[model samples]
Target: MSLVGIHGVSLRYGDRQVISRVSLQIETGEFFVIIGPNGAGKTTLLKALSGLHPLIEGDIQIRQRPIGDYTKKELARTLALVPQQVNADFPFTVAETVLMGRYPHLGLLAVEGKRDLELAEQAMEFTEVIHLAGRRLGQLSGGERQRVIIARAICQQSEILLLDEPTAFLDPAHQLRIMDLMERLRLREKITIVMVSHDLNLASTYADRLLLLKDGTVENIGTPREVLTREQLTKSYGCTLLVDENPLLGTPRVSLVSEKVAATISKDSGEL
Candidate 1:
């Protein structure tokens, strides 16, 4: 059975319908990426899969069980999420924050045991945040804080990891670092990873499969080559885009056509 199954799922926030009649399957151990323009319902779809929002229609299943049937603790044990942004006002140390991931596994009124400590330490090491173990969360840089958040999720030890624009608001270098770390986790831990991103090239490079959304509906779903085509992207994104193969990696590369080129094309087509 697929690790995640969505059948005609829909979601709404008051009068605004965010997701509409979407269905898909995420196989075990696959690196699946969701990409779309702003307000495309990418984040909304992810939240539905994480069981954060009650669906207005259709059904979502995790491990063949209805998502609504899983209790909070049961869901936490099977899945972990790294959100796009976090605000830490409490001055907890990095290690302390990571250790919190073990809460799901602890008994009622129980403290973390030796196993929890070891797992937290290992997660810190794996996320390259061990050196910041003592630093206060509020004092860290954007990149450092992001890594610490991921370490906490790692310590959760879930088989499914969901990330929402994990590289948002970071420099180019930090973005690559986080994406690389995610790839490593997927390969070494053999976990299923689902990420939402706006960067087409990044998604094309790292994802085993791509899901494209537009206006609360699925526009395309397939390999990078299939979904990242010019026609599909242009239609979904509502812009003229130039799609070609990346010279270095041979993956789909997307670029915007300059106004001059666009005008030339329009003139040649007699649309001027």
Candidate 2:
């Protein structure tokens, strides 16, 4: 069964519908990327899938059961969300922050047990933040803080993870590192991952599948090789698109070419 499936899901703010009848499925063990221009509801769709926003219409299912049917605790156990930014001010150590993931398993007045601590430690180790376990959240750099938050989500031990623009503030190198780390974790744990990314080329390289959205509607869903054609991206972004395999990565990449450049390239290839 699919780890997560959305059947005509919709979300609205006041009277303006942000997500309109979006249908998609994230199979188990797949890294799925959702890409669209700004105001296309990519983050809104991620929020709806994470159950942070109530659905305005249609239904979503997790493991064959209705998403809305899951209790808060159950939902917490099934999926974990890693937001793009964190404004944490607590003096708690990184380990303590990660241990918070075990709240759903803890009793009302009980503290985290040894098993919980161990799990949190392992998550830190995997995310390469073990050395920062004792540092305060306010003391870490932006990339380090991002890693700690991701470790916290990893400690949640959920089968599905939803991330919204995970590489927002990092430098280009660290951004690629974070994405690579997430892809590795998903493979190692057989976890289904869904992320919103503005970097279409990185999304193409890492995601096993891509879902493209346009104006709150599903534009296309397929492998990056299929959905990331020059025509599709050009029309979606209202800009010239240049699709080609990266010489270094040997995978598809998207470039925002100027109209003049695109016309020249297109005519050279006899496409125009």
Candidate 3:
């Protein structure tokens, strides 16, 4: 059975439909990515999977059980979500923040035990945030804070990890670092990853399969090669795009064609 089943799911904010009958199955240990232009409901869909957003249409299932069936604590123990923007205004230490992931497993008013500390330590070590354990979250860089957030999610010890634009504002090095860490966790811990991203090349490189949404609808869903075609992207993004091969990873590489470049090519081809 698939780890997650999103069947005919549709969601809305009041009367405006934001996710339209989107159906997809995510398998165990798969690195699945959702990509689209802005306002395409990528983040909304991710929230639906995490049971944060209620569906106006169909249902979502985790392990063949309806998402709504799980209690709040049960859902927290089953799925961990790392949103795009984290509130790090508080003066919580990195270690303290990471240890919060274990709250779902603790009894009422219970303190963290040795096992909780060990898990948190392992999570921090795996994400390479152990060195910053003593530092406050508000004192860390964007990259460092991002890693700490991911470490907290890892510390949750959930079977599924959902991320929303985890690399949105990081530098290239940090972006790659986060993606590589996610890949390592997928392979080593067998954690299922469901991420929403705007970076097509990064999605193609790491995702076992990609789901492309356009105007709150599923435009395409398949392997990167099948979904990242020039025609589909041009249609969905409403702009010219160049699709080519990534020499290093042999995955599809997508490049945006600016208006001037596109016009130049059109003029050379006698289409202008």
Candidate 4:
């Protein structure tokens, strides 16, 4: 079954509708990425899928079942969310925070048991944050903290994962590392992964499919090479730009024109 389905999903805040009849699917084990500019409703869509925000219209399904059919615990078992930011002053140790992912499995008022600890430890190892396991959230660097957040999601052991701007605070290297870890995890665990990213290059390189949103609507959905093309992106983003093949991946990569080109053209026009 497809891991996720967003069918004719529309969302609104009071009178302002952010998305209109946006539809897409993420097949089982697919690495799906959503890309758009600020206020394009990428984050809002992710929130709706993660059940943080209720759908104002239409529906979202996971594993062929509507989201409303699942209880909180059941939903947690099916989908995990890695949010955008982590505060440095939260005070919880990295391990402790990750262990919280196992709460869905715990009974009421129960403490974390050996298996939970093991899972959290394993997640830390997978994220390469084991050494920082004891470090407080306030003590970790931006990248380190981001990894810890993903480790928590790993501990959730869900079939599908949702991440909202996960690389927001990290440097390029750390961003790549987190994305690489997600790719490896998907292969090893058969998890369907969906992420909202502003970095078009990384999104195209990592995602098996790309869902492009523009001004609260799904402009296109297809493989990265199809949706990230020069023309499609130009129309969606309202910017004229160049598209070229990524030398390594041989996929379409978007490139904006250099300012010098426009400057030179203007100078020539003035002379004319």
Candidate 5:
């Protein structure tokens, strides 16, 4: 069965329709990436999948059951969402923050047991944040905080992970590290992951499949080669794009074609 299924889903905020009748299915144990230009409802779609926003139309199912049927705590046990940014003014320690992920599993008025502590520590180690366990969350850098948040999600022990712009503020090295970590976890645990990113190259590199959104609808959905074609991308993004193979990974590489350069090439070719 598909891990997630969305059918004719639409969402709106007041008079603004952010998502149109979009539908897609995500298979279990696959790495999926969602990509699009700004205001294409990439984040909104992620939010809808996470059940943070109620759908105005259609239905979403996880594991053959309706998503809305799961209670918040029940849902937390099945999926976790890592947002683009997280901020906190309180002086919570890194360990404390990570321990919160276990809330969904804890009994009423219960405290962290030996297994829970071990799980939290293991998650911290996986994300390389164990050394900073004593540090205050408010004092960490953006990259550090991002890792901490992911560690917390790992501690949640969900089968599916949803991430939005996970590499936004991180440097290149850290970005690779985060992706590598996620890939490793997914492989080892048979977890399913869906990420929303603007980095086409990164998406092409790691995603098993890509979903391209345009104006709140699916423009394309397929392997990188099929979805990242120049014709499809140009129509979806409303701009001329150059598509080529990435020399290292043999996946589709996308480049923006400047109008000035195109015009010059056109004139030179015409004069020949």
Candidate 6:
């Protein structure tokens, strides 16, 4: 059975329907990525999978059990979410913040055990944030804070991890670092990763399969080569795009074609 089963799922914010009927299966240890333009409900879908949003139409299952059947603590122990943005204003130290991931497993008194501290330390070390363990969360840079958030999720020790735009606003090096770390974690810990991202090339490179969402509907779902076609992207994004193979990875590489460049190419081709 699939690790996650999303069948005919739909959600809304008040009267506005943000997610139309969508269905997909994520297998165990798969790196599945959801990508789409803004307002396409990528993050909302992730929220639905994480059980943060109520489904208006269908059901989500984890490990063949209905998601709604699980209590909050049970769900927390089953899945971990790292949101796109975090409130770094908290004065808590980095270690304290990461240790919070163990709350679901703590006793009724909500006290951290030695095992929780060890897991927090291991998570920080894995994410390379051990150096900043004593520093305040607000004192770190964007990249550092993001890594810290990821560390917290790691410390949670959940089987499935959900991330929303984890690489947004990060530098290229930092972006690569985060992606690599996620890949490593997935391979080493056998974790199932479900991530929402806007970077087409990054998704193509890392994802085992990609789901393209457009205006609250599923535009396409397949491997990178099948979903990242010029026609599909141009239609979904309402802009001209150039699709080519990446020489290094042999995967699809997408490039935006501005009107000016499109016109220039059209003119040059006409003259030939």
Q: Give the per-residue lDDT digits (tens) of candidate 1, residues 147-167.
A: 999999999999999999999
- TM-scores for every candidate against the unseen true structure: 0.96, 0.94, 0.97, 0.94, 0.95, 0.97
Q: How far is candidate 2 from the true structure (C-alpha RMSD, Å)?
A: 1.9
Backbone clash count for every predicted candidate, in the order shown: 0, 0, 0, 0, 0, 0
What is the Cα-based lDDT of residue 139 in candidate 3? 93
lDDT of 4: 0.87
What is the TM-score (0 to 1) of candidate 4?
A: 0.94
Candidate 3: stretches off by over 4 Å: 270-272
Cα lDDT tens digits, model 5, 1-272, are 78899999999866889899999999999999999999999998999898899899999999989999999999999999999888768889999999999999998975999999999999999999999999999999888899999999999999999999999888999999899988998899998999999988889889999999988889999998888888888788887777888898899998877988767866888320
- Candidate 5's error at 262, in angstroms? 3.3
Model 6 — TM-score against the truth? 0.97
lDDT of 2: 0.87
Model 4 agreement with the true structure over 1-272: per-residue lDDT tens digits: 66788899999866779989988878999999999877889988998998888788899998789998999999998889988876667788888899989988889985998888989989999999999878899887888888888899999999989999888877889889999998999999998899999889999889999888888998888889888877687677776567888898897777876667746765787320
Q: Could you tell me how far off, in angstroms, the CA of residue 127 lies in candidate 1 after the best superposition?
A: 0.9
Higher TM-score: candidate 2 or 6?
6
Better candidate number, 1 or 2, judged by TM-score = 1
Compare candidates 3 and 5 on lDDT and give the better one.
3
lDDT of 6 by residue, 1-272 (tens): 89999999999977889898899999999999999999999999999998899999999999889999999999999999999999987799999999999988987977998889999999999999999999999999999999999999999899999999999989999999999999999999999999999899889999999999998999999999999999899899998899999999999999988898888987888420
Model 5 regions lying over 4 Å from their true place = 269-272
